[model samples]
Target chain A: MSTAVAHRPGLHSWLTLIRCEAKMVVRDTAGLVVPIGLPLLILVMNASAAGDEEITAGRTALDLYILPLVFTIVTATIGIINMPSFLAYYRRSGILRRLAVTPASPAMVLIAQVVVSLIQAILGIALAFAVAVLAFGAHLPVDLGPAVGIVALSIAAMYALGMVVAALAPTPNSAVAIGLVGFFGLGALGGLFGGRDSLPGPLATLGEWLPFGASVEALSNAWAGQPVEAVHLLSLAVSAVLGAGIAAMFFRWD
Target chain B: MSEPAILAEGLHKQYGDTVAVDDISLRVERGETLGILGMNGAGKTTTVELIAGLRAPDRGSVRVLGLDPRRDRGAVRQVLGVQLQHAYLHGALTVVELLELYRSFYPDPRSTEELLELVELTGQRKTRFEKLSGGQQQRLSIALALAGRPQAVILDELTTGLDPRARRRMWAAVESLREETVILVSHAMEEVERLCDRVALIDAGRILASGTPAELVAQSGAPNLDEAFVALTGKELEIEEESA
Candidate 1:
């Protein structure tokens, strides 16, 4: 009984929010591709071939890269698409104005949304990991603890980035445009499609500072059971703090 | 005689050089329906927005339910309900779903079935907001405002696009909320005269006159509220025409 009370508007509300977010993204066929189906397909394909192709001279394998990359993509997808969708629909429909008069604070709504994105990111990573292990000869990260930390920070950073996009785009089209550009541009450079080595010197160094880059570097390090370097830890911490601060300062529901 | 549910004292709102709500002061007592009548830029919506805590006043204070609307906004929100001047609903959800969504915000939300039935939308409960007629959508907007089972309801242009029959139905619904205070804003004098217990006519961001319909008619020596409105706002109307 005590446990249930501890969760007032707790697990149930969060679960309901997840279902709601899923329904909106799945409302159209095009929306479905971006969230679930596409990520899973990449996970399966990457994991099998990852073991064969030598990622580094040491044969680190592509399967190891898949988990962190999938995590970043899922976080971006949840924020990029859903954040703008939330604002656009509400602003257009005057739901924000209605909510402005309700006891439900806009901050609470945004927090719920961030929670939803985190849940989706975790689910997508789990699925990708499953496919990598089952389909390909992939091993679980040698240090699972730090990998989980990377996931948490990655969600925070991307959710903040998503808010920046949501705040700037007054229309849904603009939001989608901005989110897509940032997603692919940052995702690719941060090692989603390829490793950081392919980039030029300055760009590779710059990638290390990005939210996506921090997660990528941290996760890759953890899979090897190496301690997370100060640079990587600082990068992740900076991304988390800066992203959350800006999101809180700039977020607009209408 | 009782304390007003909504009160504004020397309220002012300005956007740089232009004044949106120009030192407006008004009050609506408990259970009294107040009509906010005005020309296009007369600041009716601004006043309502300030009173609803969507905007803060640059000068003076607004108290609703004995709490400052700006300082105690969340508490005010708990007790007050609002229907926007423009009816916009999230298109992704059905009527029933939208009601349920708002229902979650309150500790004691009204039943979804009861709210839909009140708006005569039970038949279309499964339909998305866009799928409904303009009048039906407006009705649903009003339904959402009442979801919290509030002490006060603000309906801005409640029946703007409604056909005569639908408008009549809306007025009936408004009139039926016996225990709730309502503030209705509209351009139609007939809506004011027919529905509101007391009316405040605004011209150029200020109230021209405020009194019960019978009292205003007796004061103006006009046969109906329409002639009285025309007489009170005739000068403001001329200014608008010349500017245009």
Candidate 2:
């Protein structure tokens, strides 16, 4: 019998793995719809009133507040809730353990899942932007570069938080439960229900430093053509680093 | 090519205070079929898992085709195919899709059609893993283990949920792999009698005896391996719980 050795998987193999990951995301109706749908719904309800009022520069309240909130929702929903649940499912079901025995490392699955989740986030952001622009006549951020930068930072921060959820959660259901609690807790403080101004002084101060609040505050500045606060950017960057560190320390393959 | 297909010596594994495998040694030469017979939780699974490099041995070494399984993981994985007890695959993936994914992980892998036919899963190629029956899932698991066309294979509880006809078909598949090394973990005496060139009886994480199925029966003064197994491993019933 031939004893030819198997080589590490190449780019084509990665594409195939990614394609399968995408299929799983698409097939889960609830996972597919909620992240985009819930945010779009919020945007539609708030866009009409917010779009009429200008906050600063050529941007309206819709651009400075509503749009940033909607975009953050897109990233947080996919990163915190959807992604972690899938990972926890794989771990609980032993898919990661099984892959560890094969030539393909389990890290391949994590990367593929991240790729798929990123695409989903992009799709959600695009849909919300389209509806806000065409239906409500909303305009793009005046400081487009900074706005883009903040959105990217927001995505990284939320996914880092999701990794923590995936690492600690023992089961798929528990992952979702934990993710939801995290989302709502952060959302409640970060102006998901209303502006942080309505919150108590110390809580409002804390909200501005958290990922969701910091993300919104930075993007709002970018929309108004103002310099993004150094503290907010620092907050997001720190959250990303700490979240990844915690996950790496606690995560198990099996 | 002349090296033993698998060699394990003084294997010891523990979980907290419980010993899963205790000072066990096993060797299988090239093209040999060794059946590891044990009652549930008798370290049969743990033994094969150690050999497969899925779990680390606290006080032993495992070599596959003369290469350390842990140290030479990449090379060892290329030549060793393992079918573990649990069917741990993505539930959303279809049979063909899962096969394709595994196929990508190897330089030379069996074709989807060939593997499906081998495991009698051709008709369910498009069916998702969660939708398959228990027996079908077991067959697919076996098919996956063979996907890489490995030189050595480890099969744990190969036909646990299979029907008689399916069991015979699986046995035939194993029979056809005569030139390859195989380590089969089983509780079925008939399976061991029919397929293994040699056998090892294990109890309490240690090997009680090992030889040809007929030799084991002869040594125990029992008519068949079933009665011989009881005679060799002690007839008293012991309820043992798995530590892992």
Candidate 3:
């Protein structure tokens, strides 16, 4: 309560900004629940339903497919829905504009959001894996390297698209609206609900080139102990580059 | 003599075809509170932004603490604290938490407790920003602007929505910082008279008059600053109808 001022060592503004943003993310129930809850829910529900179904010659539904689709849902839910909503809220509330006048640039806030969302996505993936192993006795991926690579690449691609939504949406509600559309539309076309083959001729061809569909295919292959497809990996990389580039070019502070 | 804490010369800004601030020159000496009095859309906020380096002027130059505000923005931010009219903090952060976070941006900052006490927000330390009353929020915003222990501060529309009691408390808090240079943008004549060492009356993106409260009163041949403001601005009939 004393009016005397004190001098303290200066901390890097970006670190302080990231820590504050992380605290806000933890307090945000809706932001946390969607990325964490929805993926776990899908994992348990799908596991229970696929009790004894064999999708192929020797592979059960849980063994080679459900986990990858669950991973897709995790990445898409965070990158396409949660990230855009949080960023748009910051923009609309003038928090970003306020930071512009401080020593910290608004880009630090964007980086912090991506970092926190990635951490949440990883936690979601780990929880899904635990449930898959214990409740369903699903086999682990033969090689962890390729599986991890596909997951990381997919997340990068999805989050890049999320940045596009955050940059373009004029308001928080519009960002959420655009995010949800991207989530569901990509989920359907990317074979998160089912196999890509089930889609019609033109749709299946188009979905094959999309980052979501490419990621699902690459993840499924890696999980099944097959080498990752070059085209799918390329598509995902291209999507990440293009999406991030566009978002960076068009982002507005106010 | 030390240079003025803030200096702007022939500053002009426009949005599309409409001029916001036109050919305005201002100087605020150290340890002085210069009140910028203007009606709504009088370019008071725009002038503040230009001095704070938040907006680049279409023409003219601005220097803050002897450094070009636009080119030395990073250095200027180190000593220039600004509380913008529409700026907002995160709603979920507690008062103390927000203060501490802002404190980290400066090498020398006032303690959280002191800032809260100065603004009479010590009792609301644990309250979330969204939970605070409008007056409390305004107080917190001011506290944030002062957190860096800045040499100069700009407060735009600082007491616009405050109740009379809250406005008095704000004035007292601002009064406590009399040793630091301050540029206050306000529409309240009484606030300018009580707190400002010198006042500038701006209208339609131009400064109409600049002097102490008494000088302005005498120049306008009015008994008080309120009537003097009206007389000088030629808005006497409008003021009478509004007050009536």
lDDT of candidate model 1 versus the reference: 0.75
CA shift at B27, candidate 2, in angstroms? 0.8
Q: Between the candidate structures 1 and 2, which one is better when assessed by DockQ?
A: 2
Query: For each candidate, what is chain B's TM-score?
Result: 0.94, 0.93, 0.96
Q: Report the Cα lDDT for candidate 2.
A: 0.88
Alpha-carbon runs more than 4 Å astray in model 3: A1-15, A51-59, B236-244
Backbone clashes in model 3: 0
DockQ score of each predicted structure, in the order shown: 0.32, 0.55, 0.44
Ranking by DockQ: 2, 3, 1
For candidate 3, write residues B65-164 as lDDT tens digits.
8877678767777788889886789998999989988887787789998998999998999999999998899999999999888888999888877788
Best by DockQ: 2
- Model 2 error, position B204 (Å): 0.8
TM-score of chain B of 2: 0.93
- Candidate 1 per-residue C-alpha lDDT over A26-129 given as tens digits, one digit per residue, 9 for 90 to 100: 56456546766667876766766567765543435653577667766777676666566666665666666666677766665566656665665677677766
TM-score of chain B of 1: 0.94
lDDT of 2 by residue, A1-254 (tens): 33545478888789989999998888778788778899999999999999888767778889989999999999999889888888887877888878887888889999999999999999999999999999998998888988998999999999999999989887778988999999989988899999999999999999999999999999889988898999999999999999999999998887
Q: Ten-residue segment with the worst summed lDDT in candidate 3 chain A?
A: A1-10
